[model samples]
Target chain A: MTRFLLQRIGLMIPTIFFVSVIVFSLQQLLPGDPALTMAGDEASPALIAEIRAKYHLDDPLLVRYGKWVAGIAQGDLGISLRTQQTVVQLLTQKIPVTLELATLAMIIALTFGISMGILAAISRGGPMDYVARCIALFGISMPAFWLGILFILLFAVKWRILPASGYVPLTENPLENLRSMIMPATVLGLAVSGVIMRHTRSAMLQVLSNDYVRTARAKGLSETTVIFVHALRNAALPVITLGALEFGQLLSGTVLTETVFSMPGFGKLVVDAVFNRDYAVVQGAVLCTAVVFLLLNLFADLAYAAVNPRLRGR
Target chain B: MSPYVLDCIHPFARGPLPAKTGKTLLFAQQAGRIEPRTASGKATAWQSEGPPQFLLDVRDLRVTSSGGYPLVDGVSFTLNRGETLGIVGESGCGKSLTSLALMGLLPPGMSVSGQVEFEGADLLKLAPATVRDLRGDRLAMIFQDPMTSLNPTLTVGYQIAEGLIRHRGCDRREARDRSIELLRKVKLPAAERRFDEYPHQLSGGMRQRVMIAMALICQPALLIADEPTTALDVTVQAQILDLLAELKDDLGSAMIFISHDLGVVAENVDRVAVLYAGRLVEEGPTRSLFEQPQHPYTIGLMGSIPRIDTTSEWLPAIAGTLPLASDPPPGCRFEPRCPFAGDKCREESPDLAEVSAGHRAACWKAPL
Candidate 1:
């Protein structure tokens, strides 16, 4: 099992290398020149040239990429052009907020999504199943931004139950932070839950039809035990995959969610960096997101081995 | 002892015949119950007044899917205590469906009718809760494909002990101890070490043994084995069958062994019932049925069993497939495939008629 994990981890090196190359090339190819954009239209050509030279942007694309890779090896991600601060410093401040929101969202997604999925599967043709299906449909169809606005309007603007939008640091007051985070987190979580719930329900339905489930019933177990203990555990593999993937998505894709909620997260920072043409900050944020996604996928693979011992190979 | 007294004491235990004095007492009892002058009076209510020897008595059982089409039609059989009754049929012949209906484990949308009397209560009329209670306690089942039949996440011991803990109300420690005993009974090696292993950790044979152990842990009155050995190799199949036979004798549980393999059924079961497209076509003592099959389908089944003595180029094959239950032919279900099918066979459905004493067949041209 250790050997298998080592093999999988070893394989990720080339995968991440290729991913980094693609991200770097794509960012370089964008229409606006970061140096020129930072300099602004009124700036003199000499000033632009000096700024480009200072940032080593005048170098060949390949040379710049090599430098970037080398700098990454040294734990240096360069400095943001717009914020005039180190990329690492900006990320350190912003990533925690994003992580907090995503973590909360994931917890909510897994709890509600899996429960609703199991409920829907058990109920099958009942009214609760229909309601769950409709909720999932709404989650899937409605835009995240729209959902966020709807949540804020319903819970904050009209009901006055929560603050309309903001990020409260956990250290200040954990309870207040949770209350402040719940609305945006729920919106983000629900959107993700729809996908997770759909996958979980379908997977569970398939597993329930398996001969083992019949065997469990034959053992004279209660229906709950047959479904949850026997069927659900087997069904969980697909749901696990969906959940981990959604977690990675939540980490990066919270830009629109953050903007609508007015939360100060890495998503908003990345969006701000994109608008300001802060290449270093964008690079740092994108790389961090990629690493988070990669780690999540790795965690998911490990979870598979943990959950199903057959994968451990006899 | 008079046969009438024996019958009154053990109704389900009555064999094919009664002793002379027992018959005399039975006649006396009948005479006392009804007027002697009547020629035919509702066949004397078909009473067998005695404590049951058979654990399960399923009579004229009909199971229909939600579409109002019978999946198992008019199937009647009994499982004697410590004896196995094999129900053999091709796929879609309602063999598995019959077992499912018996267990009250049919999927939602399917409905079962007719009497399924387990112990003494009519199981068909039992509430869902009562049926749930009865299952695992009095009635248990094992299924095909141990790979999928055992829960992946649970330890083999836990899976085996689950039924015992649930229905038997054994505490966790007691359940675990009993589970180990069961595992040992199934001949799993190092039963203690293996107890904590999950289903996937064990080999296919071991997993199947775990399944069997789980089914037998509760010491159920009846065990319904639905193609339990189908997924195993030929050698493992024989071992599992032997193990089941031994276990049946030890536990004294009546077993309904459902399989497509006639050889397996012949080795394990006392009585054999041949089902064709949701209908029971032939039923008799296994030896008699195999030696002289009364129905054409049963003959085809026996003939199709590859024989070692005959050096024929091609073994006999039952021609055509079993008809779909939804749109079965008018008369006999097997008429389309039966070589002896005649116009009469096509026009009228044959009910199970006594071809020989205690032997029944539902074919117009019964095998001589």
Candidate 2:
């Protein structure tokens, strides 16, 4: 396991490096010069040139990329053009919100998705199965932003049970923070839970049909043990893989959901940075998103090895 | 002694006269061809007697799909205590389904009916919970492919001990010791060291041993082995078969050994039932069935087993595939494939009736 971790982490360096290059190049491709955007619409050419010089916009692409990467190497992500705050500082403030939201959403998704999936599979073609499938269908069909809005209207406007749109750090007040996060996290989780449900249901169905499951039944295991203990462990493999990827996507910050909930997360930060031509912040956010995806992939692999011992020896 | 053994001897020695069935006359050489008035009368007679002689008595056990199409049509047999009964059939002949039905493990949408009387209770009529309690406690099964039959995620020892834990209510430590002992009984090498290994770590034979250990952990009264050795190497197959025989003897468990291989069945079982399509075409003492196969399908099956004693370069093959359950022949399920199938064979399904005292054949041309 230690060797596996080390190997996985070693592989991440090149991946993150490639990702940084891609994000930097892609940011350069966006329309409108950063200097001109920063100088404002009616600014004179001289003012724009001065802004460009100040930001080292005249440097060769490679030299600018080198400078950016060097700053990152020293834990400096450069300063956001819009706010004049370091990209690192901005991320530190926003990462916690998205991380908490994603983790909570993942917990909710896994619980409902796996339990409902197991239920749906065991009682296949029954009323409960249909209900679970219909709920999944609804989840997959409804947009997160739209669902967030609907949840806000119902839970906040209509019921006055939750805050409509706001942010509260957990350290500031855990209960209040959870209250504010509930709608957004649930809205974010629904679609993924639907994906997880479909995957888990199908995986469970296949695993339940396996020969070992029959052996388990023949062993006189109760219906629960047969389905959950014998079957679910194997079924969980694919679900975990998909879940980790979904969680990584969650960590990247769901733009529409954050906007609907007025939660200042990575998605909002990156969107604002992009719109304002804050090259440094965009680069940092994209690089961090890449790292999050890579880390999740690693975790998924480790989880796979853990659940299926057949993979461990190798 | 098996009642059938005593039953067959008495009738054969009497040398009864030929029996008429429609126009055809069955041979008198085998003896005892009188038909019973009704099947229920026989059951009543057995019940009126002191205690049931058979360990497991199946009467007209039928399995049908949700659409009411038959998968395993009316099949009946009796297993004596500690006796091994082999169910022989080609692929798609419901050999596995018959065993699954007995275990109450048939897949959803497949309905099983009729009687499976085990230990004085009709398994079919028993509540699911009752059947479940009986399953791993007094009844167990070893499946066809050990490679897949053992859960890959679990340790071999843990899997073996699972039945003990569930049925015997053994604590983990007790279950573990018993499982290791069983592993040794199955002749698995390094039983102690191998206990914690997963299914994939074991070879085909080793995995099968683990499966056997699992089935034997509870020392079930009846063990259903469905093509247990079919997935092993030829040498490994023999070892596993020998292991099963030894274990069955040790436990005195009645076994229903389902196999398509007549060779394996002949060597391992005392009596054999030959299933053709969804029907039991022939059944008798293994020795008699192999020596004198009464049904055409059974004859075909025996003829198809490649023989070292034969001079022929190419073995005779049973022609055509098994008919689909959805569109079975109107008469005998094997009519389309049977070389001896006549007008009666095509127009009417034959009931499994007495040939000799203990031997029964479903074909009208029995004793051919």
Candidate 3:
């Protein structure tokens, strides 16, 4: 098992390298002069030249890429052109807010989504199943940004219950943080919940019909025991895989959702960096996203093995 | 038992019918509804002939889909203590559904009618909670395709111990000890180590042994084994059958062995009930059913099977597939497939008539 985990980690190296190359190339291809953008439109040509030289903008692409890769190896994300702060530090400040939102979103998604899915499958063809199906359809159909706007209108403007835009750190004030996090998290998580609920329902339906479940019932297990214990353990495999994918999406940041709420999350950081032509922050964020995504998949594989012992020994 | 209570009646209603068209035979529905179990159920006391000898007595048990099409139509049989009754049939002959219906494990919304009287209580009318309590502890079942019957995710030990813990009220330690003992009883090698292994880890035969261990662990009064060896190879099939026979005799538990294989039923079971197109066609002692089989469908089944002891140039198979349950012929269900099907057979179904002291066949030309 340890060897298998090691092998998976080793496999991610090439994928991360490729992702870094793509992020770097895409930054280089963006139609703008970064040095000029850093110096401002009104700056003299000589000042742009000075900024370019200082930042090694005149170096060969290979040399610049080599430098970038070496810096990545040492945990350096390069310096932000405007703030002169390291990209790593800037990301660290914003990532927590994003992480908090995503975590809450994931919690809500899994708890409600998986339970709804279970209920729908167990009560199949009943009114509860129909209601759950409609909810899933609604969740899937509504766009995140549109849903965010609707939430803002209802909870903030109409109900006078919440702050519609901007975020507060949980450490600053737990109550305000929760109030701020609820809307965007709902907007970001609802669609994923729908996806999870649908997958969970189908997976559970398949598992529930398995002969083992019948055997469990034959063993005189309560219907609850048969469904939740014998059935859920097997059904959980697909749900875990879906969860990993949703986690990757959340960690990468829901850009449109972050933008609407002015959440000052990693998503907002990346979007603002794109507009300002801050290649360092964009590249750093993309690399971070790749690493986290791969790691999460590895975590999912481990979780799958944990849930299913057949995979563990193998 | 009293010759016949023959009556021509409509299926939807009771009492005598016009007898104008066909539809003469009616396997009378057992009259009585076991009221819902209440705290005062003991006061009812089941109004019995003092604890009937049969461990399981099924009378006219029928399972129908929501569309009112009977999947298992008017099936009746009795299982006495320590007697092994094999229900032999081809696929879709309502063999498995009969067993499932007995366990009250039929899928939701499907309709099941008829009395399943076990231990003085009408099982069909018993509350679900009561049935659940009875299952595993008193009435157990082992299904076909051992490969699929066992839970893939659970360990063999846990699967075996689940029944012991649930029904037998054993603690974890006792459950584990008994599980190992059961694994040993089923003749699994390294029973202690194999107990911790999952279904995939074991061979097909070994997995079936695990299934047997699970079913027998509770020492159930009745065990319905539905083609328990169908998924195994020939050699493994023999081994499993031997293990099952040995375990059953030693445990003294009644068995309802449902199978499609004639050889299996003839070899292991004492009595055989042959089902054709969801209806009981013939039932008798294993020797007579195999040797002097009365129903043409039964004769066809016996003839079609290849025998190693006596080689033949061609096995005479029953021509035409079994009829669909959705639109059954008003006459005999097996008439279309029977070589001796006549105009009388086409217009009217036959009653389960006594051929001898202990043999019965549902055909016009019985004891031929």
Candidate 4:
């Protein structure tokens, strides 16, 4: 298992390298120059050229990419043209807020999705099963941005219960941070809950039909133990896969959610820097997203192997 | 007058069957002995045999699906202490359902009727909660496909000890000790090492041994083995069969051994009940049933067995598959497949009738 995990991680290096090249190409293709955008269109041509040299925008694409990779190797992500702040500095400030929202959303998603799935499986073909399916349908149908706006209107504007949008540092006041994030977190959570629910229900139903479940019942184990102990353990393999995928989605960025909420998260930072042609920030953010995505997948694989002993032992 | 009644449906002790149990003379003899052995073994030894102690008595057991048609109709049999009865039939002949009904383990949505009398308590009459209490305690079952029957993730020891802890109220330490003893009883080598091993770690034969240990841990009075050795090879089959017989002898538990293989059933059981399409068409002592099978289905089954003495290129198989039980015809359940089917056979079903001193067959024409 350790060997498999190491191999997976080793393969990630080349993958990230390729992805970084693609990110650089996309940044190059975006309309408008970073130096011009930073210095303004009316600035003298000489000043623009100096700004270009300052940000290494004057260099050829290959030389610039090489220097960028070297700086990345030395843990320097360079400065954003839009903000004039180091890419790493911007990330360090915004990461805690994004992580908090994503983690909260993931927790909500797992709780609601897993419980609904178990209920649906246990009460298969009954009303509860249909209800869970309908919930999945409704959740997946609505766009996260639209859902976030709807929540804002209903809970924030009309109810006067929550702030409409924007983020607060959790350390200053944990309560307000939580209250502010609830709407966006819920919108994001509801988006992925459908996938989790569907997977859990199908996996659980399949596991419930296994011969060992019958054996457990024949042993006079109550229905609760038979389902939770015998069936759920086997069902956990797929749930882990779905969970990891969803968690990776959460971490890489919830773009629409942060935009609607006006939150300064990694997702919003990436979007703002992209439009402004802030090469360094976009490059740094993409790298972070790729590394986190790969790590989440690796974590999922390890969890899966742990649950299914046959995989680990073999 | 003969001491035994001639026409009674006793599946064991082939002779003039006693008219009824509790005659004063037989009762006095049992009272004289401080302890008695297995009913069949003791009955074989003493000239004066008392009323046999019944371990399980199922009467007119009928299982119907939610659609209200009978899946298993009018199946009845009695098991005596330490006696072995083999229920033999092709797949989907209600053989497994009969055993499941006895244990109250029928799949949901299938309705079952008729009395399941075990230890003088009518099991069907008992509430489901009571039946649950009896399961893995007084009545236990081990299914075919030991590969799939055990929980894969749990240790063999945990599966065996589950019943001991739940029903017997043994603590973790005591249950562990009892589990090891059970493994040893099933003749699993290195019981201590095997106790902690998971199902995948063991071979097919060893996993089966673990299943047996799980079933027998509670020392149930009646054990239903549904083709326990069908998945095993010849050598492993014989080993498992021998282990089962030894366990039955030592534990004094009545066994209903269900199998499709005639050889496994013939060697292991004292009596045989042949089912076709949810009906017991013929039943008698194993010897007579094999030699002079009166019902055409039973006769056909006997002919299908491959014999070493006969050099026939093909062993005759009972032609055609079992008819679907969804809508049974209004005659003998086996009439569609029976080559000996007469007009009467197609017109009416036959109830069990005495063909000899003890053998009973459900057929229109007997002693064929």
Candidate 5:
């Protein structure tokens, strides 16, 4: 099992390398001049050329890519032309907020989604099942931005329940920070819950029919034990896969949600960099997102081994 | 007998037959170990003779699928105390369905109607909660396919002790000790070490032994073994069968053994019932039926049994396939397969009729 894990870890190196190459090349291909975008229309052509030279824009494409790769290897993601600050420093400032929101969203989505799924599976054809199905459908159908606006209107404007937007650092006051995050978290969580709930229900239904469940029932176990102990453990493999995928998606989804809620995070950082064509910041933010997704997938694979011993052999 | 009593006996009587006083006395004797006649002396007083301390009594059981079609139609039999009753049939012949219904563990969308009287209580009529309580306390089931019967994530000890803790109300520590005891009873070597091992860690035969230990942990009065040894090798099959017989005798629990193998049934069961397309075609003492099979299907089954004594190059097989229960042939379900099928066989469904003093067969033409 240790050897298998080591082998899987080794395989990730090449996968990440390929992903980095594709992301680097695609960013180069996009139509925009970072120096021009930073200098603006009022700037003279000679000043734009001097700024380009300072950033080594005159170098050949391969040489520039090689320099970028070397800088990344040394933990220097270069500097943003628009912000005139180190890309890594800018990212460090925003990462915690994004991470907190993503984590809370995932927790909320998984808790409610898995419970609803189990209830639906047990009740099968009852009203609870119907209601769960409808909820999931509505969750999937509504856009996160639209839902965020509605939440702000109902809870903040009309009900005076919460602030409509803005973020508070957890260190300043934990309760206020959590309160600030709740709306965006709800928007992201509801969207992801649709996928998690559907997969959990289907996987549970499949596991419930296994012969082991029948044996458990024949042993006169309570219905609770039969479903949770014998069925759910086996069923949860697919849910784990969905969870990891959704976590990766949460990082990407934060862009729209962050924009709507106006919470400063990696999502806003990427959007600001993209509009200003701050090449260094865009590269750093995209690379960070890719690395996080890759690590999360690896963690998920390891978790699969932990949850299902049978996979240890593979 | 009074009219009420006579009315009660009417369903059992048939075709201008004389009163079966001698046969009734013989049935009483074969049933065995009855206390001396009670002073009440009321007619049919023998009906409450305490069931011979038997294990399971399934009578006229009709299990229907969600589509309202009978999966197991009108099946009835008894498993005597410490004796095994083997039910043999082809695949999809409702053999496993009958066992599931007997255990009250049928899947959703299926309905069961009939008397599954375990010990003295009518299991079918009991509330589900009551049935749940009775399960694992007085009755247990060992399923086929040991590879799939055990929960993969749990250790063998936990699986075996689940029933003990649930039904017998044993604490974890006591249940753990009893589980080890059961493992030893099933003859697993190094029971203590094996108790912590998961199902995937064990061999197929060892897994099957674990399943048996789990089923027998609560010392249930009846054990429904559904093809327990089918997934095992021939040598392992014999060993498993021997172990089951030994455990059944030691525990004094009755067994309803369901299998398609005639040889295994012949070696294990005291009485045998042959099912075809969801109906019993022949039933009698195992030895009597094996020696003189009255139904053509039973004879076909006997002839098909491969033997060391025979020199024939090809063993006999019942020619046509068993009919599907949904679209069973008009009269007899076995008519399509029986070599001796006739116009009368095709025109009427034959009820189980006495072919000998103790043997009954459902066929227009008996072995004679």
Candidate 6:
């Protein structure tokens, strides 16, 4: 098991290297030159030259890449031209808000998605099954931004129960913070719940038909144990893989969700940086997102070993 | 008169039939305590007495799908304590379903009816909860495909001990010790290590042994082995069969051994029940059924077995496949495949009739 973990972690290095190369190279093709964008269109040629020299714009692409990589290795993401702050500083401020939303949304998604899925599978072809399917359809089909707007309209505009838009830090007031986060998190989680529900239902149905499940029943195990213990664990293997990928997607950012809620998050930071041609911030954010995805995948592999011994050390 | 002579006197006998005298001979051979009762004078006593008590008495047990199509129609047989009864048929002939029905493990939406009297209760008439309580406690089953029959995620020891924990309320430590003991009894090497291993870590034969250990851990009175050796290697198949027989003898558990292999059934079971298209075609002591099969279907099945002793270039396979479960002939289910099938065989279904002492066949023309 230790060997497998080490091998998987070792594989992430080249992946991060490739992501960095791609992000750095792609930032150069955004049409506007970074130095010109920083210095305003009406700026004199002298000002432009100064800005270029300050940011190493005269250096070759390879030399610039080496410098950027060296900075990253030293935990310095350089300064954002638009914000006039270190890229690391911007991330530290935005990451907490986004992490809060993502984690809350994930908890909601897993709780509703997995339980509804199990209910639907157990009472197949019954009213609960159809209800679950209908809800899944609503979740998968409705756009996140639109759903957020609907929640805002119903809960904020009409009911006047919640603030229309904005975010509060949990450290300031936990209650108020949760009140602000509920709508956006629901919007994001609802969409993911549909996917999870569908996968869980199908996987469960297949596992329930397996011979081992019948053996479990023959062992006089209660229907609960037969489904939850024997059937659900096997059914969960595929769902776990899907869940990790989904969670990774959540952690990266939800642009539509953030924009609809007017919340400051990683997606807004990354997106604004791209338009402003803030190369360092964009590269740092994308690299971090890629690293998160890789780590989540590694965790998923480890979880598979824990759940299924056959995959252990292999 | 011998029990066989009394059995032959009953015309078109259906429902519960007389006990086989061969059972006594078998008990004598196996236990060596009960003297063989082959003499006519001793058999005469059995003939005059009331029906002997049966450990399991199934009467007209039928399983029908929700659409009301009969899957297992009117199959009945009785088993004595510690006696092995082999149910043999081709695939999709309801051999497995019959066993499943007995264990109350029928697939959902399939309705089962008729009497299954075991341990002073009709199993079919009992509430599902009661049946669940009996399952894995009084009645246990070892399925055909061991690879898929065990939970791959659980340790073999945990799975084997599940019955004791669930039914007997044994604590974890006690259950674990008992499971390891059972693993040793099943002849699995390194019982303690094997108990901790998952099903995938074990070979097919080893997995089957683990399954055996799981089924026998509770010491169920009735053990249903549904094609337990069908998925094993030829040599491994023999070993598992031998192991099962030895354990069953040691445990004194009455077993309903379901198999398609005639040779295995002949060697393992005391009595043989031949099913065709969801009905019992022939039933008798294994020796008599093998040597003098009265039903044409049973004869056809026997002829289909390829023999190394024979020099015939072409093997005689049964002429046709089993009749579809949805649509069956009104008369004999085997008429289409029976070479001796006549007009009467196609007009009306034949109930089981005594062909000789201790032998019964469902055919219009018995004693053929």
Index of the highest-DockQ prediction: 6
| Poorly placed runs, candidate 6 (over 4 Å) | B1-51
Q: Per-residue alpha-carbon lDDT of model 2 for B1-368, expressed as tens digits? A: 34443343322222111222221112112222222111112222222347658889999999999999999999999987777888988888899999999999998889999999998899999999999999978999999898889899989888888888888888999999988988988899999999999999989999999888888888899999998977775556666877888888889898999988765665567788999877888988776676677998888876665433346667578889999889988988889998898999999999988887578999888877
TM-score of each: 0.87, 0.90, 0.90, 0.90, 0.89, 0.92
True contacts kept of 4: 0.50
DockQ of each: 0.50, 0.67, 0.64, 0.49, 0.50, 0.73
Model 1 chain A: worst 10 consecutive residues (lDDT sum): A305-314
Model 1 Cα displacement at B74 (Å)? 1.4
Ten-residue stretch with the least lDDT total in model 6 chain B: B9-18
Q: What order do you get sorting by lDDT, best first?
A: 6, 2, 3, 4, 5, 1
Q: Give the clashing pairs for model 2.
A: none
lDDT of each: 0.80, 0.84, 0.82, 0.82, 0.81, 0.85
Comparing candidate 1 with candidate 4, which one achieves the higher DockQ?
1
* Candidate 6 CAPRI assessment class: medium
Which CAPRI level is candidate 1?
A: medium
iRMS of every model, one decimal? 1.4, 0.6, 0.8, 1.1, 1.0, 0.6
Candidate 5: chain B TM-score equals: 0.84
Candidate 2 chain B weakest ten by summed lDDT: B15-24
Q: What CAPRI grade goes to candidate 4?
A: acceptable
Question: Candidate 5, residues B65-115: lDDT per residue as tens digits?
Answer: 898887788888766666667798878889999988877888889999989
Residue-by-residue lDDT tens digits, candidate 4, A32-93: 88777888869999999898777777789899999999999999999888878898899998
Whole-model lDDT, model 5: 0.81
* Model 2 per-residue lDDT at B10: 29
lDDT of 2: 0.84
> Which residue pairs of candidate 4 clash?
B5-B17
Off by over 4 Å in 3: B1-52, B309-311
